[model samples]
Target: MSGLDIDRAAATQMAQKYRNAAEDLESALGGLPASVDGGIASGVLADIVSTLAQNAADLAVLSRVMGGVIDATVSDATATDDSVSESFGGLTLPGEEAAP
Candidate 1:
């Protein structure tokens, strides 16, 4: 069976990057209005802006979700490693003396 071998440091860093991107997108896109007033071709501009904003919002949400998943996966992997290590700590290897 294939085993999981997650690099916690790298995974955590990637998760942080995703979180930062989400924050950046939300901050930048949240200022846009669905419709701007008193400008030529404002209707067309508004429609474009509206679509961009929706897509940005969706992407930001997905980024946040991905970050959360990575964080959770790292946490679970670490827990499993610790558990396995603890379980193995009591065992004596071949040709090795047991602890007194």
Candidate 2:
């Protein structure tokens, strides 16, 4: 973990929490009755529930995408860190102390 940038990991964890919430909401939606009470307003209720389910799905997808972005960002950062270390490894400027 030395010299590692943790912001991307934190973002990935946040996105995972949102993904969990979306899954929970979708699970709850699955248990809803087709028609509560009589048939009146059932269609509207169903449509609302459907829209909510779709929104949850969208949120899950978005969270996943954010996680991917975080992973990519972390990977890029690691690569840059490696490149910088290699470029400066064992190199000393004039009048500067060399790292042991």
RMSD of each: 2.0, 4.6
Give lDDT tens digits, candidate 2, residues 1-100: 5655567667667757766765776677678776555378877877887777788777767766676676777778878879989998989989999898
Candidate 2 ranges beyond 4 A from true positions? 1-12, 18-38, 96-100
**Any residue pairs clashing in model 1, and if so which?**
none
Give the local distance difference test score of model 2: 0.73
Looking at model 2, which ten-residue stretch has the lowest summed lDDT? 1-10
lDDT of 1 at 41: 83
lDDT of 1: 0.91
On lDDT, the candidate that comes out on top is 1
